[model samples]
Target chain A: MFGLIGNIKAVPGQRDALLAILLENAGRMPGCLAYVVAEDTADAEGIWITEVWDSAASHKASLSIAAVRDAIDRAKPIIAGFGQFIETRPRGGHGLAAIAPA
Target chain B: MFGLIGNIKAVPGQRDALLAILLENAGRMPGCLAYVVAEDTADAEGIWITEVWDSAASHKASLSIAAVRDAIDRAKPIIAGFGQFIETRPRGGHGLAAIAPA
Candidate 1:
């Protein structure tokens, strides 16, 4: 499975707003095995998004969905930048549907 | 729920060795909701471990389990260092059992 782990840095004091947008759009995409958004404990302006998808294509394709596009547009301003972006090959674990290792 | 995202840096050319130890211990803890290990695309020596648990205490308690402790011992030598460790509070998302927002 395809996986991504990254930190989204919100504009100072805009973390919650960015988080709201993220949570609102969570789990609505096709081929998404998991899409978890969490509040970063140390960095007040940072949020972590951990995702597992069936394939990289599915993840890329979700970008064209209208609601996802809208969320991105809405979040553009408050998004200061992104950091620690890493692409991964998920080999599955508990709470996830069984995924054959790639 | 408790969440953690971090990168484990393995000694040169030992990523797969470290990864083997991690994968061997995956998902056996009682309160662990998810524990996905992945190969970092950008860093040849890096592995990302994304974890979610029922609570922080459960995560801490896991360290005491014989199997977990043994895995840690086996992994210690090949582990060069750690990076980007972040604690998080997970609200909920796809593939996770429903978690009440904390």
Candidate 2:
């Protein structure tokens, strides 16, 4: 499993628009097992995303998709700073035992 | 479960030290099911964290501990913006089926 983690900033009032973009490309993205977008309760302008993909390659490939590209382009103008993507693997938790190997 | 997500910035020269503080309280933090601190591959100074807890109350209580307090206090100077915390529950992927009912 792979992860695509990002720290996003929504424009002064473009929060809804940004969320829509994320929703748009989700599910359709190959290797996407889970996609989560979260808003910081204390700071509405800040947002966090956690995605699980089949591989790092699939995640990179998602960037080239038309819909994904468009959404990212639109978001760029409103964003202040884009952090580098961090990749992660699930470490612990029996709650995720379903993910155990056969 | 609950979540404690944050966007943390380590001082220009204090990344390793900040991580040490987190490591110190990690195992001891009550109700802390998982605590993750990830750095952005593209931005050396940017970081993302995702924490899962037993409950919101337990997460709050963890903050009152001496170790947690020291870590937070040490890291605060390096952090830029402390967003309000947003809690989340795991949603999908059979991988997490282990967390389901007995």
Candidate 3:
């Protein structure tokens, strides 16, 4: 699975707004039908978001879309750094959800 | 961070229902300020969920709560297998969101 792992920081009191933006975008991304956002339960200021798209191509295709561009733009300052990964399970229990084509 | 990575399968033709449950619990989890969901980019049948919690204790505490228990109960039969991880980033380009104590 090609996962986008973004390191984003929440505004001191506007974390909820950032979350709303994330929810809003996740619900709308065609290529990204599944998007997950989580935070450091203790620190409240740190947030981590992991998202999977239909394919690497579909995810790339989404970058130019208005909604995506806007979300990123709105979130740019909030993000501390960006990390992206295209992973294939190497070992361990029942690996990731990289399903085979039908 | 103590992250729960479950290898849960979606009921045939009822994936949306599972997604709804995830959304519901995520919104209510006291220790889980962030929850993100994603599916395999190409395969329609595969799904992957990654979640982070306040602490191992907070996550464990949440499981006993009504919302979490109900989510698990309602979702267990649908799950194909389960995988749990308590991770300390071995190394990477800017690691996880494990914040320091106040």
Candidate 4:
């Protein structure tokens, strides 16, 4: 599976606002195996998102969805910037279940 | 629970070697909930690690373990550098089991 890990910084005092918008419709995309939005402990304004997709193409296709597009637009104003973004191939983990591709 | 998401870069031509070492001793960490290592699809020499620990204190204490220390030393040479490092507070999610504190 394809994985994405992103580090996001929210505009000062807008962390909660940004997080609410992000989590509103997260993980609704097809082929999404796991999508987690978490609060950053070290940085008060930082947020982290971890995602696993069935494939790279599926992940890319998610961006075009209207819900995702809307989320991006809504979150734009509150977002300060990004830090580290990386992609990876997910094997499997203790809590991460395996699902066969249809 | 506490979460850590970090980006790692492997020395050129040493990605596999680095991955092997990393996976060999990973998840053996005390208080560790989930530890996942994946290869970066974009950067051939890049790696991403996602971890969930019972608490920040547990995570901090893990660094001093002999096995963990040895793994760090062994993987240090093949490691290129770090990218985005962020700490987060994990709630709960699909495929992620919930465990009570000791």
- TM-score of the first chain of model 4: 0.91
**How would you encode candidate 4's per-residue C-alpha lDDT over A5-59 as one tens digit per residue?**
8879999999988888877655467777766778888789988888777889988
Q: TM-scores across all candidates?
A: 0.87, 0.51, 0.45, 0.73
The clash number for model 2 is 5
Q: Sorted on lDDT, highest at the top, how do the candidates line up?
A: 1, 4, 2, 3
**RMSD value for candidate 2:** 7.2
Q: Which residue pairs in model 3 clash with each other?
A: A35-B37, A36-B36, A36-B37, A37-B35, A37-B36, A38-B34, A41-B54, A53-B41, A54-B41
lDDT of each: 0.83, 0.59, 0.51, 0.77
Model 4 stretches astray by more than 4 angstroms: A26-28, A64-73, A80-84, A91-94, A100-102, B25-30, B64-70, B80-84, B91-95, B100-102
Cα lDDT of model 3 by residue, B1-102, tens digit: 455444345766655666566556553555553344555344343454565555667667777988778887887666554333313211111112224212
lDDT of 2 by residue, B31-86 (tens): 66555555545555556566656567877888798877877887788666553345
Between candidates 3 and 4, name the one with more favorable DockQ: 4
In candidate 3 the C-alpha lDDT for residue B87 amounts to 33
Best by DockQ: 1
Per residue, candidate 1 scores C-alpha lDDT tens digits across B39-65 of: 888888988888888999989988998
Models ranked on TM-score: 1, 4, 2, 3
lDDT of 1: 0.83
Least well predicted 10-residue stretch by lDDT in candidate 4 chain A:
A93-102
- For model 3, residues A1-102, the per-residue Cα lDDT tens digits are 356645456767666667666655554555553355655454455555555555667668778879879987887676555433323111111112233222
Please state the CAPRI-style docking class of candidate 4.
acceptable
